[model samples]
Target: MSAERQLTVLSREWCHLCHDLIEALKPLQAEFGFGLQVVDVDADEALEARWNELVPVLLEGEVEICHHFLDEGAVRAHFQRIG
Candidate 1:
């Protein structure tokens, strides 16, 4: 799969929800064989501004998938669509 097919998680190191989302995505990443990129939103000014309160945002390229939680159904649907 291409990089665009990977899931990007915008998060902050101090956010518990961010950690939880990453943990939740582990099995899905394995099952779907998709790459998962975790980025600290606080590391970038723009990202931090846009996603500060919405840390743990899941994205497929520029498309927002979910925030503060892992939406398994949406994730599975994304895989289905990509495949």
Candidate 2:
């Protein structure tokens, strides 16, 4: 992992997709040791406003990995390229 590279999953409360993502990514984080930050959009007003409709967004620094849907293949590919 790059010293400065980290993964953040933006999500919100009562989001089943977010739950699914957390379930799906547990292994990846465990395997590759990617720093994962799951932020609940609803927890903060600013986050809620910015990402209220963009929940489940994956971010590597300022670059977006994907959004709404979790594409495991794409995510793995991104990690490989960025790792």
Candidate 3:
């Protein structure tokens, strides 16, 4: 698979729902064989500042799908488009 196929997830420490988001993505991750990076927004001051309120955001490269929750259909469509 190409590097762009990887998935980036922006999350924050102390966020309870981040786990939910990750769990929701399990199937897609396995199917696409995409690397999942959970970026702690708190670690980057700027990112934390910008996306603090938008935790649990899913991204494929720079393409953002849903924030605050996993939209399975939307995410699946995104992966299909990418593939």
Candidate 4:
């Protein structure tokens, strides 16, 4: 298959929800063949301001799939649509 598509997670240190979301997405990444990128929002002022409250935001090429929690259904739908 082609190189996996990039999926982004906007998160910060000490965020359990962010960690949970990543853990949940690991299996989906394997099934759908996408790569995960974790960004520490606190590291960037703009990113921190924009996503501080929405720290576990899941994005597929800038289109948000879900936030704060792992919306598995929405993620699956996004992958299927891209496919």
Estimate, for each residue in 1-83, the C-alpha lDDT of model 4 and write its tens digit.
Answer: 23468999998789999999999998888887787899999899998888778888999777999999999999888877877
lDDT of 1 at 77: 80
Tens digits of per-residue lDDT for model 3 on 1-83? Answer: 45446788898767878889998889877776778889998889988887778898988767788899989899878867866
- Ordering by lDDT: 4, 1, 3, 2
Residue pairs with colliding backbones in model 2 are: none
- Most TM-score-accurate candidate: 4
lDDT of 1 by residue, 11-81 (tens): 88889989999999988877877788999988899998888887789998888888989999998887778
Error of 3 at 28 (Å): 1.5
- Runs in model 4 lying further than 4 Å from the true structure: none
lDDT of 2: 0.80
- Per-residue error for 76 in candidate 4, Å, reads 0.7
Per-model TM-score versus the true fold? 0.89, 0.79, 0.86, 0.92
State the RMSD for candidate 2: 2.1
Deviation (Å) of 35 in candidate 3: 1.0
lDDT tens per residue, model 2, 5-71: 5788998768898888877877877777778888887888987787778788888777788888888
- Model 4 TM-score is 0.92
- Identify the runs in model 3 with alpha carbons over 4 angstroms from their true place: 1-4
For each candidate, the alpha-carbon lDDT, in order, equals 0.86, 0.80, 0.82, 0.87
